[model samples]
Target chain A: MPTKTVAGVTVDVNDEGFFTDPSQWTEEMAPELAREEGIDSLTDPHWTVIRFMRKEQAEKGTGPTVRGLGKTSGVTVKELYQLFPKGPAKIAARVSGIPKPRGCI
Target chain B: MNSQIGEQAATAGQPDPIEKVSVIISQGSLEGVYPGLIMANGARAEGIEANLFFTFFGLDVIHAKRHEHIKVASVGNPGMHMATWLGGVPGMSSVMTHMMQKQIAELDIPSIPEFVEMISDTGAGMYACKASVDLFKMEKSDLIDQVQDIITVGEFYDIAAGGHIIFT
Candidate 1:
């Protein structure tokens, strides 16, 4: 999956067909792929982190590195990855309700 | 039965007849809790009788002591970088919960404790699911004092069968 736009903001969704704008993602569509799979619902940190990833994607046309996001947030890369063991791309992709970003494994 | 109320005018050529609605919320996650409570409170605001059934994990919302401790899950969510974006969101899980609680507070939305209080105040009926209680090993002592009954699914159905059924 590539970047999709909603309200003019392009977000990076991944290959699982996960990252699209929420407007394009229906309630039924979201839960079918991403409910409680090693993860529960999107929490406050999720809102923060995913929004950060989208902002990065918007500015750069690609998702930022976990290290980059972590560095910016002033937390260690280990902590970032620890927080998102599934990786930021997959997590952000799911919450944005878009397809998996291309090249996500 | 908002729909039934809507239909009353069509059938009887009168204003909607004292329409009522009931909702049952089964999930207990922080995110899942408020929609049910808000809907019930909103219904009450409109003077529609709303009943809420708390079951399974949703029990946390109505718990006397656990009410304030309800937390949001951020550890392994999709878009896991929420902390990076928010720049230090505070009391997010508890805070958001409290903000919602505050809405109920200001609007006088009831706490699990207060909800029981207002059920009497507003004449709304509240109950706990007996099977869930047993499954969770909870007793009446575990619940707030206001629960009208510890009911079986069938018991919930007895009261909820005719009205609108909502599972949040």
Candidate 2:
């Protein structure tokens, strides 16, 4: 129910800053959202993860967990941490305009 | 009510999120080993630094030859929903372990060996107990390559300082 302005576009988000309705997200809004997580810019590898996350969430109705990302995202687990910093799966889901993944691992 | 309090505190920035965890696995049964592994993996998933210390029978979980073959305890486990005597029957342990493995696989949970590799790749530390290693007459080479070292309880405490310590 909470809305925030990112990239001059208003989007609904939860208390944790994850998008509540992913449909409202646009590619242009990602850089600003990534900044909120202390990432100054989105590089090629970051885009790779973000794109993979969006596709997975769109197909599965939820984002993948870290293990799933490591297994299938074409990105290794160590690389994910280096790209997304703290909490790669959760952060990637946020930047990808998906709700937080519900899996524990 | 507790959750509400936590939310309020979070909003006020009164407490920090958990930044680290140390999990001690002291048992070898399939069920016994999972809780610690799951917790350690979950911590790393959340970007929390995690360490797993395997001691006593828990070393079976890291043994080069036995790690992949650890079995669920069929006998004397009331949670199995069967008679204790029936569980003691020959082949019961294997059957139950197979069934449990299938169920875990269905849930997308990794097997013990694969899970360990995944966790290790996430930068989570894995160590074996020095006392337990000596008791079992195992050299460092006997453990899987992922284990960082054989360490004493004091060393584990040193690493676990300023974090939650969980014994399973």
Candidate 3:
């Protein structure tokens, strides 16, 4: 396991920088992690998704799929791409302090 | 240090993730179409650009009337585990297709049309083969609205340049 320091706290992470123990996450660390994922700022829509991801991870033990996010999250799929370019689900999961979603779509 | 060696060292050890994918779907069976759709959708989910080129029988996937009603082939498919003779019986293909649709529904996978919409919403390109359209005597209005264009094999190659090409 690797470790990363964010928001003045050190935590265990996987080789890809996803948190190994999501319990160690705090809201304060979100903006910093988002920055690490190349998101320079956390807007209202971004927080909406991050909060939704955290809650979904707590119940499901994994982040939602892209389709699931589009169906459930208030943010549309196109908006998600606007918020998190490149890989929306993967980057959002990393910022939300959850494991990568295992679904193929 | 030589410039050649420096360039090699700079490019050699860096990880290069797949940035794009062009999936060619040449089969029209339910099983065949789903694999290509799944792979193309998966590529977009991973932040990779994806283009789906539907040719030959695969054009049924985007056909306005046939896209929503693709059936699983019961005969000549070993994966079904039934005798080939039994698979040829009337209504067997429908039964198998219904069963497969139920299973796919249980997994929360969308129907073909819905899946196509989802992929389009993700900005993945969808194309129909011009040669197939001509052979089938189909018009532009025959395809779903999601299809960006009807292109030739050469055009597909031009768009797929520098990306992974998957034939299914």
Candidate 4:
């Protein structure tokens, strides 16, 4: 229930900074969220992944797994790490304004 | 400046040892293959290097002909519900395998072959045990394309040096 402001938009975020309710997300907030996730810039490849993840979450009711993202997101796994280090799926989901994907562990 | 001091402090520590994880898969069942695959994928997602060494019965997990057909172990599996006697019934293993596969599918998990490909594509090294290959009379041709090599235990250990080793 904690709220944080990103890109001048107020949204619900968990302690881990993952969005609690994805409906409040906006594309404009992605850069700010990405910065907090240790990414200073959103390259086209990053946006490609973020947009793909948002679309998948909206349609599938859950975000894609890291493997699924690597295989289908038009981004290779090696590049995924280069884009979102440490934890690509979790960080990408957080930046994309989606819930933490299930089966990530 | 505070940021300068923080940067100095960060660099003062010894460089972090490369994060490497070696996962050994010793069972061939559907349940068996997933743990190693999931862990390796998770590790790579975190920017860590991961290697999977498949040995013994685990060879089936990477076998081109068998990887896609791994079945759940029903008999003697305490996790399975129903009497042990019922587990021995003919066709029960297939029933259990189907049920488990359906449950995993409902969770949207990819099939075994898909998982192997995904993990491999993610840069995790997939190695088949040389001893198992010789014992089972399997050639390199018998393995899925994702397998990086058929390696000896000694070779696996050499690759695993300075890395965390997990047996599943």
Put the candidates in TM-score order, highest first: 3, 2, 4, 1
Q: Pick the candidate with the highest DockQ.
A: 3
Using TM-score, give the best candidate's number: 3
- In candidate 1, the second chain superimposes onto the true chain B with a TM-score of 0.69
**lDDT at position A11, candidate 2:** 88
Writing each residue's lDDT as its tens digit, candidate 2 over B11-118 gives 896567899999999999999999899999888878799999999999999999999889999988989988989999999999999999999998999999999888
Better of 1 and 3 by DockQ: 3
Per-residue lDDT, model 3, residue B122, is: 85
Candidate order by decreasing DockQ: 3, 2, 4, 1
**Over 4 Å off, model 3:** B1-15
lDDT of 2 by residue, A1-105 (tens): 888998998889999889989899899989988998899999999999999999988899999998889889899988998897678899898888889999976
Candidate 2, residue B27: lDDT: 96
Candidates 1 and 4, the one with greater lDDT: 4
**Candidate 4 off by > 4 Å:** A1-42, A55-63, A67-86, A94-102, B1-18
Q: Per-residue lDDT of A1-105 in model 1, one digit per residue for the tens? A: 576543455555544445544445443443333344455565556556666665666666665543345446544444444445545455555654644443311
lDDT of each: 0.58, 0.91, 0.91, 0.86
Q: Which 10 successive residues of model 4 chain A have the least lDDT summed?
A: A78-87
Give the 10-residue window scoring lowest on summed lDDT in candidate 1 chain B. Answer: B113-122
lDDT of 1 by residue, B34-138 (tens): 667666654543346667788988877667777666655543444434553352355555654555556655643334544434333344567888888889888
Better of 2 and 4 by lDDT: 2
Q: What DockQ does each prediction reach against the true complex?
A: 0.01, 0.73, 0.75, 0.42
